[model samples]
Target: MQYFIQRHPLNYDGSQLQSLFTYKNFGLMGDSVLVFRGSCTVEQNEMVDMEDVVAQDWIHSEDMLHFIVEHFDMDLEKTIVRQRLLIATIKEELEVRGVTTLRRSGDDLYAGDKKLSVSIATLSPVSTLVHCGLNISNHNTPIPTIGLTNLNIDDVFQFGESVAEHYCAEVLSMRLARCKVRGVS
Candidate 1:
């Protein structure tokens, strides 16, 4: 899957967006200023929950592994190992940074008090993806509508962008190392 992160206005109303804005000022506008859009292809498989409860059609990561090995010519075992290590490191960093309320259950990380959930998975053998969502309800209007909210859109975009840059650097380093070993440019 491919994704994009872009800037928007703090207010949903189109009129609030200024004709000229710097990235720093745009970030100051916060969550309402960023949007993340993506599409993914999911393969389904059955899995048992923590309580041994069976669940159907869970998103399978094997397809992603196959795609990555086929397209990127990376070793599947090495990629999976790196992904596991990266996720564990991220969780530890979050805790060390004082995000003590969040807990990891399998691949899903949750912040119960904040009504936030973040899921991390290997999108491709060599690539990992992070998804974040918030639970919210709008009560000011007569019509009642409830949905998962995006109160930290900017934060999410920044995190994703950082991950992408890091992954690209790692891939480039691997290619360079291989070339050096083979006496190639």
Candidate 2:
């Protein structure tokens, strides 16, 4: 259960609909540009700049999926394929760690007679958001469930860093392969 924040850049036009930044290296998925905008203090004076500021803030997995579908005009079939692929990868990873009882249904993974559940969502084509929850019961009486949010930021950050590193390396390899195939040196 790790999460990474991805920023997407938008350019404002006369209309409310903004344009997304695309990169050639991203292949069919396209790329998102990370832009950081904040107020800067100069001489003890804080000033706010007035710009179109076409940007989407840090969003959760579900929100990120919707944002991609809407902004990138992704078809439903492609979305479902991506979602299934991501869930399958997560299921395989969990199974490798001795969690063989896990069952995947749609975007959720359940284990131990519903005692544990992990909901997987895609933040983007390359990134996944996994939220784990544990069910607690007292003599057949169910109690409030505990979730991954209880974990500290340091733990989450460490996990996310590892995942990001792996993902970036895989993406870079794929891009390089494509470049070589295209005879682009």
Candidate 3:
């Protein structure tokens, strides 16, 4: 698994969660995760989660830290597991940074009652993809939102790097664990 932090700010519009997005856009081949600071406004047409669309829950934030994860294996269940893993990894990182009151409900993370992140996973022909976005600034959000700034996290880039590193390590470790296990006949 490869991890890359995108230095430039890019707007996430729900369309980047596709197969080869990291390879085509950032040149990171194979299973990879790309992190970046950005603005999020998922257009309806680009939305993947049917529940969100049916409920008319718009995904928008003025500023966010986005994690786009892509794996070559196309398994929706596994992809959802990876999505939750990333969320839990973020929660762990937050706790490490002294933010202990975080709560994770499914794929979303919350600081008390205010939402801290949004995420979704889906299949894209050749790959399973996930998009997780953390609020950086509590601005222009549709609902009550809490951001990294509110959590007293000043170094956004460093925080993002730590998250990417830990998530990649966990995923790689899991893969190793699978390989090292002997199947019972």
List the RMSD of every prediction in angstroms.
13.2, 14.1, 0.9
- Global lDDT of each candidate: 0.32, 0.31, 0.92
Model 1 gets an lDDT of 0.32
lDDT of 2 at 142: 34
Q: Write the per-residue lDDT of candidate 2 for residues 1-185, one digit (tens) a residue.
A: 11233333222111111223222222223332221111111111111111212232111111111112111433545435544544455355445444466677775555544423222222333432222212211122132222222212123223333333443444457557877764445
Q: Which stretches of candidate 1 lie over 4 Å from their true place?
A: 1-54, 59-71, 85-100, 103-153, 170-185
Model 3 lDDT per residue over 28-71, tens place: 99999999998999977998989889998889999999999999
Q: List the residue pairs that clash in candidate 3.
A: none
Each candidate's TM vs. the true structure? 0.35, 0.35, 0.97
- Which is the better candidate, 1 or 3, if ranked by lDDT? 3
Model 3 TM-score, all chains together: 0.97
From the highest lDDT down, the ranking of the candidates is 3, 1, 2
The runs of at least 3 residues in candidate 2 whose Cα sits more than 4 Å from the true structure, single-residue gaps closed, are 1-73, 115-154, 161-185
Best by lDDT: 3
Q: Judging by lDDT, tell me the better candidate of 2 and 3.
A: 3
